[model samples]
Target: MIVLFIVLGGLLWLISLLLFAFSAWASYKLMRLLWGKIRRALLRPGTAQITSYEVFTPDPEDIHVQDTRPQIRLELDCERHGQRFQVSLGPLTCEELFPALDLPAHHIACWLSDEDWRQLLEKRWVTIACDWRLRKAILTSQIRNDRRLLLISFLSLSLFALTVTLSLLPH
Candidate 1:
């Protein structure tokens, strides 16, 4: 009886260790995601006029870079707090998270629609959400679906965690 009790306890301890490792990984990923958002929020928001942009599509004929997506290169003139600067950003790539199965279209952030891409090209202006401290600039357009996708990711992760927790309980 004592031996059986010890074996059960060891199994439970092993399971707990696995759970701890998984939880730590999840927390690390969450923290990294949240930290990026916080950093972006803290930065001063500014819009940079897209002075010029060039779209580069990798040669489909070349096997070397055929699988690569299109890249957008931009020259931006940004002004913030009476200080104006010109910066170049690219080759920017966008991919949507949940892409439609039927379409062959390339997406930025895995969600940017064909129409949005067209407008971005035609409008010749983009919102510059940049981190000056990092010397990096991110050009973005508003998309409602982006937020929905983020929510979905969180919910899915939470659901997975719940499932694991439930399975660990005595049945």
Candidate 2:
């Protein structure tokens, strides 16, 4: 009976480890993808006049405070020959918390060029370039943050599984 319990515990541990490893691998790939996106945004630096901005909030998980920022997608009328495009800016993270704890919607803190900000507030249609540095910073921040959250969740789950398994063993 003791040997059976031990074998089961080992199996559980192995399963948890496998899950952690897979998630870590996924996170690494995602980080690389995000880095590539940042490089592309920097390289392109497309010009467009703002039509409007659409806010897209992902299913707000109470994952962590840092993961709470909503994504803002820009609707633009491109400059060269008046082509229209919806350019992705940043899924920006912010320092401030949402006003209500129950509310999933809140503002995010992110960097933007002064001119772009003013134009954003005034709702003026002005030609704008992709703010390469700010976009890169936002992407980097999100990559690091999501990885951190994944690790934390994995650790917590592993700990819980260990505790439950050990307690069930006939000591």
Candidate 3:
């Protein structure tokens, strides 16, 4: 009778350990899922259109290549409100801006080769949150939604970490 009781208790402990491990793994997976969704949402970004764009090509003859680096000046027009602003950015290749964004081969190729910057800017609407300086002007209702999602994701991650830490502690 004593031997049977000990065996049953050991089995229960092993099962609980397995359950705990599984829950931790599941939480991690959930966190990753949330992040993927958030990234995808950011890929399209906010409601803004580029009315005009200027690409400043550096002169090879210029000695100060650092200062005369390839820059793009964009005239952003917010669709939500009739707000207009100018944003200056460096060359934004598909590989640079959306490195993790899984775009089609043709789209990536077009973005890389397009001299006029049409493929990236003129073709579609972009997020007004192009530069940090313009954050105050651009951050509207969309920012709130993004913040809520981020908060939830962080909380989930923190909970997962705490669970793992507590589980690792000596019983």
Candidate achieving the largest TM-score: 1
TM-scores, each model vs. reference: 0.47, 0.30, 0.33
lDDT of 1 at 47: 62
Model 3 Cα lDDT, one tens digit per residue, 1-171: 999999999999999999999999999999887765465345434545667666665677877765343455555654334545555433543333232123332333432445545666564555444433333323333445676778897899999999999999999
Worst 10 residues of 2 by lDDT: 94-103
Q: Rank the candidates by lDDT, best first.
A: 1, 3, 2
lDDT agreement of model 2 with the native? 0.49
lDDT of 2 by residue, 42-123 (tens): 4433344445655545666655644533545544444333534444443333321111111243343334454644454234
The regions of model 1 sitting more than 4 angstroms off are: 38-45, 49-55, 61-70, 75-88, 93-126, 142-171
Across 1-171, the per-residue lDDT of candidate 1 in tens digits comes to 999999999999999999999999999999898767656555554566767667667788887774467666777777766866777777655442111111344544434455665555553655565555565665433223334556687899999999999999999
User: Clashing residue pairs, candidate 2?
Assistant: 94-109
Cα lDDT for residue 159, candidate 2: 100
Q: What is the C-alpha lDDT of each candidate?
A: 0.62, 0.49, 0.55
